[model samples]
Target chain A: MTEAQEKNIPDVSSDFEPKIVAFCCHYCSYAAADLAGSMRLDYPTNIKILKIPCTGKVDVLYLLRAFEDGADGVIVAGCEEGTCHFINGNIKAKKKVKYTKKILDDIGLGGDRLEMYNLSAAMGQKFADLAKEMTERIKKLGPSPVNSGA
Target chain B: MIVGEQKPIEEISKMIAEYKTVLVMGCNTCIAVCHAGGEKEVGILASALRIKNKVEGREQNIEEASMERQCEREFVDELADKIKEADCVLSLACGVGPQTIVEFYPDTIVLPGINTTFYGMPKEQGFFVEFCGGCGNCVLDMTAGICPIVRCSKSMLNGPCGGSQEGRCEVNKDIDCGWQLIHDRLKAQGKLDFMDEILPPKDWSPARHGGPRKMVREDLKIDEKPEDEIEGITKEGEK
Candidate 1:
């Protein structure tokens, strides 16, 4: 495996730290991430979490802005399917993610850089695992095209 | 209300190429309600045009302004000073506004920044459906208030034509069959018998067939003053 790929693995020591923006729904994913921290679970500190009232509140424009502002990758963490506290908020988030993926692909950013993950508030460990997984995935993809110049 | 959308960015950019100073005009009437040519849209379009022009390395002086109603002569007349400063005007209003600008400023180049669609009503937050043809005839009483002329795929007065299948139009599966909706609505209201009456061939002359139509009211007429007499008149007297 390449040095970059090896650096991406969870718990593996390396100097590389991917800048990730996690848009967590307040009802579920935000609480889960907090729980993971309280549980003393070790996860990459590279991710910056932005808590929103609902996942549906994350607009496509926000996703594009994140990338434009030098986020290597973006992960929208919402409530598990059919479990959104705000009714169909998570479903709407999923639709926005799908739409944003298409737009990212069109703009030559590679849609895989953005992802939508669902987890209940109780799944604290899973949230950490997702963070590790996405960070490593983004590490392998290298810095975002927008950030490459800087 | 008239529904319209802004012309493509490239097209608008090309139209304003020759002019060093351009005014982006918006209409705050029907197009505004439909969320097409409103003040907000004017700002968005202006920003986009400015950015696109800058990116293309062709810098032009562009200004933004909007009026309450562009189709009215009085409202358009208010833009005399702004129009005088601008070499060209890019009207964000529907077709009528651009024509009105042309009528007012014969020497100024009037360009349309929007493609006028049709008279429509807001179906939902962001969706507008064409609902009127401006046929100069009122047939809503007979059609249960549904305008088949505008909503129907074929504009058939007596329809649910052979192409209608499963309550949808054959041309577009997404479109609900206008006749099917009309029939169901009329049946629910116990007015299905009205369908049996054949609609007469609509008179096209009242709409577009005849030369331009006009409505004149003698009561609304203002007596023209002789040039010598008007020299003594003030702004208050004109009203």
Candidate 2:
């Protein structure tokens, strides 16, 4: 497969440190990420966390803006379904992620660059795992064409 | 309101590729109301373009500004200084706004950031339904306020054609049959009798068919010269 074709999966190599923007919900994902930090889980350090009131607040425009602002990959970390503190915030975020994925695919950025993850605030290990997984995945994808040549 | 949608980012990026400096212009009127082109959209497009250009290592300098209205020459005049600094403009307004910009600054290339959709009204937030064709004829009186010319997928004035089933159009089950709506509305208002008035075919001359449309209201005209002209006249008088 061509480099572009093969770049869709996680490539855990030493030379890649993908820039990731994680839009974490305050009630769950943010706490989980914090817990992960306290636990000393050694995840990739490329993930930048932006805490939001709820996952539903992650608008599609914001996701696109993240990519536009040089983020190689984006993750909307919300509460697990049915466990959301804000009723349906996670569900709404899931829908937005799906919509954004379609948009990304259509725009030649590839849909896999954007992802949605769900975890409870106590699931610190999951948060760390997610961070590492996303970082590796994006590293495999190579630099976003939007940031590659630069 | 005229509803429009922004063109895809890739398409917009390609359109402005030749220019090193670009002004992303947004209209705050109809396009804004429709969530197509507005201050928010301008910022979004500007950021997208900047990132895309940066990724390509093209060194494009893009800036964003929004105007109250792009369709009017007076409103567009505010862009003079900003436009002068850019090699091209990416207009996020409806088709009318871009044309207005072109009229004022003939030398600059004005690119359309959005696809001009249709003359429509918002059905609800984020959704719009075409309601008028600007046909220059008032047929809504007979059809009970719903415009078949625009609402009907076929633009059939005397329709509900063979494609209408139950009360919906065959083209899309989601769409209500235009004539069905008209019939129901008229029936409820006791104006069903008007449907038999045998309305004649519409005259299209007043629309685009008759060379662009214009409105000259002698009553609204002021005898005094415009402000710009008055300023020039004052300078001449002082000299």
Candidate 3:
């Protein structure tokens, strides 16, 4: 209806292909993603997987960089609670995710763009499902304001 | 040690919006341990600011520098050249740190990037509690190391007033009763005799109530000449 509103609307004709980053922990989610491929499970190609030793290694800086570098949405998948390869890495990552989410809200980036989940090595189906779910969510939110210049 | 927390990125972004070039300075001593104004925090804040720049489609020079202890003159000196190059400085240290920098570089515009909170210690990982009031005089020995000036909700020298219930202060149910802690500690150490002794009223003048206090270590002076006699030397140093 308005120029500002028009700018925020994702271009549907060209098909908005949102770029998503999934920081997968080596002990669990990474293996699950690998298994997803072997099992011929379907997940959106929009998601780009980055292997990290532990989710605890994910810093607020890394998440900020992803969005700043044109990521429409970001996911941090680590081992389930109390089951981290490193004692409490996933718990620490959960806190960092919560912290970064608040930071995203502060910067007007919409905290909903970032999400965190706890997964195990055998949950290939769950991993693929979350990837598709996040892809759909980002598609609904449209391009990040950082990339859209809105 | 002084404890502090960095102000929100949005708040800091607003403070430096008018300046084209900013120097984000950090102090690594106490604030660093608290994960606030340390070298690592300086880098984080700088990166966040850069992201804001991209989001807003604006560009500015953001420089980062950190000192071992910004409150100390020796450490603050390391930032002098960097401070001179920037249009303004965003200081991520405690209250004393920004003042120390301003005292040296009188012409520079210094903006606070953090809020200096209190004289405190880490209660545990990621949590800090204020323990001291910096009252200039301490009553720790009489109270068995528990400070009534700060730890006590009312700073009551003879407390546990009707407000204390079940070892919790009335001010906040989560806070421990300062006098209750003192009483328990004194009883445990067999030092309850302190309770029998009527303590004298404290001298408030020794604290911040006296206004702008100074500590002089005459022995540490290089030249002990009085202020009036050093006119030529001091005048030159002022510039």
Candidates, ranked, TM-score: 3, 2, 1
Question: Residue-wise lDDT of candidate 1 within A1-150, one digit each (tens)?
Answer: 766456643233545578999999999999999999999898888889999999999977677667757788999999998888888998988988997687566545668989999999998899999999998988877766565431
TM-score of each: 0.64, 0.85, 0.92
Candidate 3, residue B21: lDDT:
95
Once superposed on the true structure, which residue ranges of model 2 sit more than 4 Å away at CA? A1-12, A38-42, A82-87, A102-109, A144-150, B170-174, B223-239
lDDT of 2 at B88: 93
Worst 10 residues of 2 chain A by lDDT: A4-13
Model 2: colliding residue pairs:
A146-B55
Model 3: per-residue Cα lDDT over B1-239, one tens digit each: 78889998988998999999999999889999999989888987887787677667677778999999888877777667898889999999998888877777777899999999998999898899999998899999899999999999889887768999999988899999999999999999999988877778888898999997777678887888875655454344353
Q: Write the residue-wise lDDT of candidate 1 on B83-201 in tens digits.
A: 77999999999999988777656777889988999988888977988889887876888888888887789988888799999999999999999888888889999999989988988
Where model 1 places Cα greater than 4 Å from the true spot, the runs are A1-17, A148-150, B1-129, B158-175, B190-193, B206-239
Q: Which lDDT tens digits does candidate 2 get at residues B1-239?
A: 88899898878878888888999999999999998899988876676566556656788899999999998877887778898789999999999988877766777789999999889989897779888888777677778899988778887777668999999999999989998999899899998887777767778787678897777565787755665674464444221
Prediction-by-prediction clash tally: 0, 1, 0
For model 2, how does the per-residue alpha-carbon lDDT over A1-150 read when each residue is reduced to its tens digit? 656447544344547677899999999989999999899998888999999999999987899889987789999999989988889999999988997787677656778999999999999999999998998789878777776554
lDDT of 3 by residue, A1-150 (tens): 666466666654448899999999999999999999999999999999999999999998898888878899999999999999899999999998999888877777778999999999999999999999999989888888778666
> All candidates: CA RMSD in angstroms?
7.6, 4.7, 2.6
Evaluation by TM-score, superior candidate among 1 and 2:
2
